[model samples]
Target chain A: MSDDKLERTERALDFSGIQAPEELLRMKRATPARIGIGHVGARYKTAAALRFGADHAAANDAAFSEVPEDIPARLGFFSVQTLCRDKAEMITRPDLGRYFDEEQKARILSSCRYAPDVQIYCGDGLCAPSIAANIPDLYPAIRDELVFRGISVGTPFFVRYCRVNTARVIGPLLNAEVVCVLIGERPGLLTSESMSAYIAYRPHPDMQENAYTVVSNISRFGTPPVEAAAYIASLIGEILEKKKSGLSLKQNEE
Target chain B: MKDVLMSAGIDIGTTTTQVIFSRLTIAEKGGFGAAPGYAVTRRDVFYRGRVHFTPLLPDDSIDKEEVARILSEEFESAGLRPDDMDTGAVIITGETLKRANAKEVAESIAALSGRFVVTTAGPHLESVLAGKGSGAAELSTRTGKLVANVDIGGGTSNLCFFDDGAVLDTACLDLGGRGIRIENHKIAQIFPGTKRILEAESIRLSVGDSADLPSVRERIENLADVMARLLAEALLLLPESPTLRKVVTNRLITCDRIPEIVTLSGGVADLLGNLPEDPFRYGDIGAFLGASIARNGAIRERLNRNTKETLRATVIGAGNESLTLSGGTVFYQEIAFPLRDLPVVTLPMDGANPEAYGEAIGRAWERIREDGETTAAFASEGLSAPTYEEICRLADAAAKAARQKDPSGSQTWVFVFATDMGKAFGQAFRRRMPPKTSILAMDSVRCGDEDRIDCGDPIGRGDVIPVVVKTLLFDNGERETI
Candidate 1:
């Protein structure tokens, strides 16, 4: 026998690498190494919402309580929320949260009156932590900007998966020229707290993407949310003046 | 009084369907409220023809009836009956329509809805994205040439060119994450136990699992490389001058979303780890050989200035998409909503969060939906639902074929050859087995149809056939050969 054959014969049959059962190899080739995009991690889109806080946790109760009349939580445009934190349970489980839960809906319906020129809202997008952290600081700036422009702002309402399409729903709801939505951006590895604005002209369910503008990377460490809010308000200004949102208006400007 | 509304937007996408409820709101006096200067618009509900996010099958068919049923259910669930919607916009993707039944399925959905569904197909996803909104106008202003926006999705990549914010050309390629998973069939096998658990949790249906992990991963990587080249080649076909900037994706897909600021939305450019300090400074002479594209002087300057704070490009692009409009018509008024083709870049999973993955997937899918017309070469017709048992059977048959063809163990012996060749052989061997059977590389293998069979032993000079066949087998499993 040739030296190669002798060596080959002496070598033990390496069976350790057999991953699947021997029966599965009959018509099989080598295992394919498909290196493409992977769903390495996933949060179920249809699961029940988890509530982390205690006492205030709405998950613990299925009923609504009346708000004290004396309390100054009275309806104001600034009091609007684009997303109710309780609605966040609808993130992965949209079915559970797609529609407003009863009490929460009542809270919004009673507190928010309709027919402003533009309804500005902030939602607990993909990152609740960021929404909670930034809204307190950013709301005032945005409100002031809209008020300064003489843009009639209405009580804000939030939605789940508050996409640009959400603006379309808001358009008819507010009977406004536009809807400016400040919601949590889908969080990335770079940062979790970033927020984006979706501003649609003649907002409606059919609103196009260009009708919305985004100002993202809203971490306090980056562009302060307050500053970002100011810039967004200005963009809304341009949208109103030009009556256009995307490349078309930009070109006419140039 | 019950209100009636009718409108549909068919997002014939690479992975899933996004049906928008066009018009269904009560212009109620106190509903949106008093002294209301705002418009109250509502769509009672929209229907989604949620299909399996896979590539088209050889048979070129889809479950039309099932899709229609699901859509009808959605409409009913939304408190609207099928007859309520009078006008609809059926958005067709070029890739999903390729295998033949795309029109049939789309028509079926339209027929069921009982509305005026105008079915249209653009070459790339960017058209859909542009239609949604993106600064197609400004880019055209800067560069006199019509601008093309490419969107990379989970199951396809869509490219679109706009002149003064109007679409000129489009295309789509089925080279997305879902497509990769289906073709490679690795994820299904590697974590069978995990998959069962996940399915039990109702995360994803167990229709396409049953392949090996390594083989699937190998096929996925090879396809990724091929997809990048195909994308570059597609861009070369366009007449627009190459923008000097070369954008880099997360896994170093250099040409994913570079070249222009399609919109001023900040997040679109922020997530890709930041643009190169002088992106326009360097050019791959060999790569952009035919296209005489000069880099945007202003954009290059902007990148240099804000290199420190340009992540979340997709989010900002999504924002920009929201801020723009195409075709001069108000969004709600137009029957066919224009799709925006935002430049999208994707990064590999370097231990990123699920939200990031979802975002990447969402962005890529957006591109596929927007620019499906232009990237026709890369489109898949539709993801036909297949059972796990069928996939397993296919993988088993492929493995058996490999074993029979190279029975001497001589073919298997090649596993001990030089490192690269040996690795390739081993990879091929694995792909021949299990869930790896699902992937189909465009030009990977030569089968019995060509009368090309491997010789009993290795030839001294190395025949190209074996290597190619080996690669083909590795990329796809045994049963996947044409």
Candidate 2:
């Protein structure tokens, strides 16, 4: 093909996806799933392929990026680090991400109140962008709900290179009756900016995996952060009342 | 996987009254813990009552006792009771709404039928419902073409245009099958509107006139010709005829494009098919009107003969097409579970400054207030792809607006959202606004500029609510479409 002709073909290959019927259009609008996108033979259309590539790149970037330094100060929370020394270590050694370093543990012990009603910790898990995007709205909503309900809250803080299980370590250390860690979820091809909350009441080192109650998918496209915060605050009140989390709480609710 | 609601529809028209029983199935399509929502996945009409001449009293008022008796008998034959109904509508249509006791009769039937049955009347709404019932709305969606449903009943012809399953515009005319009533093959009475038209056409017709005369047939043809001309004017967007304009009721054709297809519905529509060939059928000129429409060359060329319904459209639409299921993720206080007939005001939010959102909402609320609608629901097409910060901003603005309107925070603030962000925004608004302000915020309820909504108690484990949207703002001065 001639160069000009090739350029034209490439430009024309910019298929604008599918033309769905009105009924299907309503269904498609209500969801974020990749549906009704017509294919070019066996492959996805060029536009859809390009979009997938872009979303994948975003997910990888979110997984590797560090939380910005000023985020903690902006949110009025102090920062600490897990035993995982750096990003590479955090990715390779999952076990190390669940514990705090000795020095950081002492700092936490000094700064946080003992056996408070609720202890909140922000963690940059697999995706830092999720934390960066959601925390400002989520933090205040959670605080206001808990405060209005007359629940005592300990000093809030942030953790770097943290895993969800870090709540198992921090909860017992601060003698917290209930601990909630809002951590970044593993990035997906569709969304990298999603967060999840892990709540445990009186968590112990040997607590089973099912001991924690989790509310996941907090993002712009998911259960939005502000709403999730309200739900979490109410869940905490239930946890404190029933003195249970996870399976027990679920059973109690049923 | 699906929940079924048994619904009933009672349509009281000028000459005939009928009942319909339908089954609406709501299906949950949301994936586990994902964007949860429910929709009316299927609707089926199971029972259709035999059409009967409407019972009227000496004063031309509806016979309430006789109407209730007919409904009870129909319910018993259908093997259903009033308590079996989940939600439905009782519509008083056409000239029947002009009856002395029309509202009272409709209200009585609604009370006797079910807990959530809605009663409404008006030319515009009747037009829209008939169009939906006649399947013009669904046809528009299937064919991707504009369709107009013209319901020619006893005392009115209601015209409603639909595009892609949504009502576009509606018009009504005081032309129907019973414009002139015939008794024992003689003219018993002529409606004043029909008399004026006959005088203008130079046709001598009066009460007690011989119905067997050729000029009487010509008068009937004249009424049919008027109907045809008015329809042409409405469909072609032509200027109204000076003589015909007097009979034009409600809004006129405002849609930019002409309808590609037309469907005829109502009792007069029964004449389009084989209807026992009785000229004095039901003691009205309905048969002649239907014959005139079928033979009118202007209308014949445009009519789509294969309609989904004829006389049953209004009843079917009222029974099955009226109720919509709200989105699953919504916020509602227990105290405000079943709010009815709250007018909806759509706030302009597109390309608007974030700071001015409160002022825009305040202005919209004030407009509704001027209409003496004290408690109203504020509706908006929420921010698209809103980020957490954007949500907070919108919520803050909404909180400010609510507080400014009700400083004491003792009243309940209702908001309807066309986007999936209702729960999020409701939570933020609750947290920011004064503690005393009760919030009833819901999503996925689409409202037009002139629409009002009735919200029923939450259903499906409190996951969604039943909402009925009534379009009533057509008479309000022109406004931009949202």
Candidate 3:
């Protein structure tokens, strides 16, 4: 990121003596891939190889970084952690990442509003940096839209070292009509700030994966965070009206 | 869910008339409910009618009844009724659009053929269509090269430049094949433009001139060579000749740069396929003109050896390439199908400044009212992934400005947005509009100044509007830069 000129140059096909320079430049505008790097003696150029290495390191940092508890507290949401202690266990022991003790459960019910029309929260699923990058704009877009529609939403919070399955426990425990989880997606070469939203209607302990409706690949570079928020808002309205989500919702659409 | 729509293209040109029907597949992307952003994913031309000479009465007016009969017969042969078609275009091109009854005749014919739309008639639009139909656009898109095509029809030669499949600039000239007609080797009829050119060249041959005079034949060949040189100059293959300005019709081409490939189309190009021995075989100067153009080294050097189409480029373009789909989530409560020729007014968006945005909307509304339009499409290049507050602010400003002008909400309001924020803005505008107001908001569509929007019936799995942005006539006085 430090070399601004190199960042723009590597993404474009700027090889010398191109017959159709304008057309090749147009193709460059359409994609984010590393292209147009002319090789010397059948090997990668030094700058291009270095840029690839730099991008790989950034993805790793996004995966291993932790979102501080103070960040969620500033947004007026209480935070809790799962059974996993660190990033190693969160990645290796995904089964442990889905659990919470009785003491933490007591703290959740006490701090959260009960039986609201909809409940939404965030989790550091795989990329913690994505949470701070998108939530400030994303959260209000969804909340204000639902408010305008005269739909009620419950208390929001954060869960550390979380998995997608955690929404199942929160759904039945709070007795909410619908539950939505905004979490970070696994980092890819193109972007480390992408996030996802998983939603369901009336969750239970034994619910399957197909029970949740999901929208993913959300970031400033992918689907705009605010645009994704607007879509999630309307989706919540449809789920409440139809009383369904995931496979059932798709079937009903047919 | 996948839906297929049947479409027909009817071209009423200066020298010939034709009809073509195509099946357009509308695939629901993302999912069925997600088809608000929809397009014709695939197009297959199922029926192509044989070319027929355009029938003209003694008074030089198009024979309306004969035209109608040709259309009916073509549809019957294709096993399709007019009602079977979901969307299509009827384009009256070249000199035919200048006839007194052109608009009325075109409208009636369009109505006779399903929910068809007629273009107002513009050379730029025609140039783009011909470029597309002739495969020049596709060639540039596929090979990543700059391509240009000259559609040499009966009364006009349209030059369009394509860079990576998008139109860059267009120009038209009063050059064509049917300038002089022949019968039994004798001159039968001469159009006014050809008469003027002949008089300037000092060639005294008139109608009913001797069929086998060597002097007259030599003069005609000289005229053909002169025209071929002009065509070469138009593509910058040669130096700009002295007569270049006099032959240009509406506007001059501003491509400025040389294209990698150039293609020829229309009837003259069709005639060049095998270099007919008889110059007057088709009762016109087309064959002789084609031969002369083929001999011109400047054009031959850059010509595309593979011509995808010759005589049917514009007609195929009209039929298959005219339909565009509206995208993003949309909101339209009670709009009727096939809304044709809604004049567009583009409102200026002052980026995050609500007060400036409101003033801009108010001024644009006044312009629409001044133009005496009962309904118009308001277009904007919308913000990227707009936040909720930004959407609300803009929507609120627009609603308030509109309320002051048309308090009773008698005029229908249609917002043509440029991004997927259509439904979001639609919902916000819906909440604040007057109770009697009806609105339509659609996005992922682009339109230019002076263009008209024609929205066909909602089709397929999603509420996707088959939209047509028709630019019939335009004067690019100050040419646009890339």
Candidate 4:
């Protein structure tokens, strides 16, 4: 690396004007927040402004981009599309992203197994790169852990222009006891590659928001994909034992 | 919202021995459902014992029996027993560790002092502890300035540099108050190390010399000048002078940056900056030397002088300042809940070269084997939020390196983290390892390359573990650097 790049990476966020810079540094290390970046009078310093702009652009790109075709094919899983036709339509119509189109639904029903113990799927929610970056590590870990516990998982697949609620749509179709969707998170300035796992036990169309439990920020700069995968698998085990998810499962755990 | 524990600190120094008792309140700081983060919310010293002369035998070895008696008496007077202390340390400091029976004495005291008291001695550890007790650590954190603490006890002057509450470097010199012994207002004997200072100045002062003589005062002033000059050179990171080289105990001074402030602690510190007119009050040249230090122009101009304790810094640090709380998001086996005195081997994980993990771990394992140590804790600073593939690669490398060292898999593999990803990393590592292999992982324990750690059982239902990280030199090979 160039000396300037090395120096920039090593240097901590400058909070010289603050009375307690160590406190600010400690807080900054705890999270990936844009705090402690000292301002230049009325605005952020030039470097800080440039970094913010770059992150924002990356987030925009993640939200509008399409999931690559080779990722799912390489994993031996076929892909299906939601009712939304394109990225613009997916953004405009939230309901269309939640459910598959008539033809795509028929393809999923014919290709996937029925009444499995667990069903896993991937989605390009708001950031397709999140799935492309995280799933290779996450999917295998979750699959292996569940298999080790003797839980049968259904034929996993991918959903294009997917939403968090897509797990609810697929759960009843596959007749699975548990459904989990690993989808891209809505991008933020701190990170555009962050992903989230939304899980529900015996999800149905009439299920309330509390029926689903989410573990978010699965990225290189967030929870770490391998660790998050293990955590999600453990949560799935608990959900199977208790036959519940979200608020009820959390309360029972306490 | 906090759990309280009783602690005790005992310091056995060259000239004096003392004990202190304190209370530490540990509490969780993060919001509900957040990853576990616990800290020592409050530390309060409840009792401070009287300073007693270190009992010595006729052979110049520490009198272990007398020392134990004094400690028992003090504990009784304080209305506490050895079982009452939850955790603490009994540290032998200064030149006392050089005594023929120092280790035996230390071990005996550690056994009799408390339920979980640790015995430690070394210049670097002493320097850091003294700095913490003298308030230099706190001052550095508050002011964001580098502060050097010089703790001049009876046998050695230990210098520890602190930046933002962390120890950066350490050095030790054979400079102290009790180097010259006096009796009946006359010089009874001068230690061999102190004799070098007199000879360097071309002043011939020997046993039976009158303490009231002008030559004695001049020798004391010269000693003070040597100490001040040593500090000046250390701040500039220069090689030691010929005079300083003769009295140097440890040559390690790793920090390149000069300190903005300097603090004085230990026995002779009370006399500095404001010397008593009666110089012979202690029957030695300690008062005179303190006065010389106060009058030293270079030290006064270059560094700001500040201090919180004199003669009690090491004891206070041992009793109250040594304990740290680990983060709650940890993974460990129930059987290995409390592990002590494990040497910390920090793995180089700069992430610049992805292929170096196996090689780096192999090199570290070789060093651990060379040291004849079977169990060690591997530590790293930046394992936070790594990609899944990266974590798997690291786990694979770690497992392979560990297996190479002990193919039987009988040893416990402990991983220490400086970041908040211990739970995640531990889970990932466990998924890759055999079920029979024991794994213990903890986070938020900041340790240096040369430090050793003692892990206590988790507190209550929280996942936080009580840890004491220290640098101790028990063997001759480790004594090369303080």
Instruction: Point to the candidate with the largest lDDT.
Output: 3
Tens digits of per-residue lDDT for model 2, B395-472: 778778878888877777888888766766777777787775777888878987667677876776565889988765
Clashing pairs counted in every model: 164, 0, 3, 1
Better of 2 and 4 by DockQ: 4
Candidate 1's displacement at residue B307, Å, is 19
Best by TM-score: 3
Docking class of 3: acceptable
- Local error of candidate 1 at residue B482 (angstroms): 29
Whichever of 1 and 2 has more DockQ, that candidate is 2
- Candidate 4 per-residue lDDT over residues B399-471, each given as its tens digit: 7776776676677888888866565567666666666678888787888676788887678344677888877
Worst 10 residues of 4 chain A by lDDT: A1-10
- DockQ for model 1 equals 0.01
TM-score-wise, the better of 3 and 4 is: 3
Clashes of 3: 3
Candidate 1 per-residue lDDT, tens place, B1-482, comes to 22233445445554444444544332322221011111224433323323333334446455566566556665666677666654454544434544467767766665664433334333322343432333444455444444544454443444555554545555444333233223233232212222332333333423353334445334333333333444454444322222211211111122443334332211122222223332212211111111111133332322222221121222222212211101100001011112112122222221113234324333444454474422111111111111222222332443454344334323211111111111112222343433322211111221221111111111111111111111112112221121
lDDT by residue for model 3 over A1-254, one digit each (tens)? Answer: 11232355555334676776666556666666677666668977777677777777878988999997689988778898888889899999999788887877777888888998889989989999888888887887788778777888888889999888888888888888999999999997767888888999998888888978888877766566766776788889999999999889878866
Clashing pairs in 3: B37-B327, B121-B472, B122-B472
lDDT of 3: 0.80
